[model samples]
Target: MKYPIMIRVKQKQIAQLVSLGKRLDGRGLNDYRGIQLEVGVVGRAEGSARVRLGKTEVLVGTKIELGEPFPDVPNQGVLTVNAELVPLASPTFEPGPPREDAIELARVVDRGVRESKAIALEELCVEPGKKVFIVFVDVYVLNHDGNLIDASALAALAALLNTKMFNYEVKEGKIEVKPGYKPLSVKNYPIAVTFAQIDDKLVVDPWLEEEQVMDARITITTDKDGKICALQKGGYGYFTTQQVLEAAKIAKEKAEELRKLVVKG
Candidate 1:
């Protein structure tokens, strides 16, 4: 999230437009751009999804493995999330270890699902503390226009919905795979909405141009029950109390629209 020279100049211009009650892309302060989502995009993965938000593109794949549950949560299954920012995604992204930006993206998406209780972990448990299904959610940033957080979250949720778990039977302390398969037990739907602060205005779904100039960003995740599940704020900017409330209202309104796209397997 380092600001380059050109990016800083563009951000200043966007801030000026925000002060005039306008956005760089001419979208309303609370309007989201068109979203495109597709499930089962990767044939090799058990479950996969791709999401495009404006110019940002993200892909998610889910893989399940049988393993012992965590000592603290033996009765429940485990959910592990990881994110990768390929060097080809953006010039700033390197080829080696993950940077802070990638870590933050993974945390934001993971918190939304974990806090929302979207997955029925207990259903994934096979034998209390002995064995359980561990769900691995991997997110890859194919393109970095802006707003990777929102795109990644959408892809993760969609991939989870498309996942199919193989039936298993425990015999003589050994787990055997059954012939039939069942869809992952998804208990709730969670959607994330991101807002960028430019000057004094908060704009929803900021494109790369606007993001380069914005001062701060906020993401809100809400469940199908209309309950706020998680909140994350990024960048070195300040938000007033009133602005935070206003952003929440906008996020709640937009979340419902996006939640409709999460298909059940």
Candidate 2:
């Protein structure tokens, strides 16, 4: 992935500025771009949300249905995640099956929610082993400024928070769907914070240009208790133990800040 000559020159300028604690966009080294969140954007979906982080935008939709339980987790509900990088979102994105980056995005977001136990899946069980609820979380990238991982994760969590599941009843040893709907059971809020390493500086919420020049990227997902739930590292660069620890500390604070925008009373 070789960039153009102009891009290479710009990358050098960015690195020089970063060494002096300055960014091309005039943001502080650790400062994040502006974020905006909207839930219940898709009326047809059981749950849905849209998130904007700087120029990046993503939409997440949650669909719930009754299905046979998994062999091992028969008593608990199931959760599946899928992500699509729409070709129109970015020039580099192509239309086709899921790519490696898209697959990794889904897995990272899934791990954050699953490991944090954000949703009360047990309550979705219609029967002990015969039937249970299945939640499908689908993420779509509407814009690709950079840092899709964090934006997609935020949208998924927000959609889950706005989810409303249909009521159900059991009769004659069979589960029956009811008309009314009830809010999905949620237990925790897990948010992911991402940083891009350019030269020796680690910047929060990298934009498109910064991402292209970055040496590495790290995303850390944390729960409300400020405990790390999941982590993903990208690019070929390495991070020292001290760098990882510092990233976690920064993730905790930023996660809390982002949580306030999506979580409601």
Best by lDDT, which number? 2
lDDT of 1 by residue, 1-265 (tens): 5678888777777777788878778877777777899999998787899998887899999999989999999999999889999988888788988789889999999999999999989988999998999999999999999889889999999999999899888898889998988888888888999999888789888888887777889999999888899999998898999999999988998999888877543
C-alpha lDDT of candidate 1 relative to the true structure: 0.89
How many residue pairs clash in all the candidates, one count each? Answer: 1, 0
lDDT tens per residue, model 2, 67-125: 88888988999999999999999999999999999999999999999999998788878
True lDDT of residue 154, candidate 1: 94
| Whole-model lDDT per candidate | 0.89, 0.92
Q: What's the true lDDT of residue 144 in model 1?
A: 94
* Cα misplacement distance, residue 63 of candidate 2 (Å): 0.4
Error in Å for residue 201 of model 1: 1.1
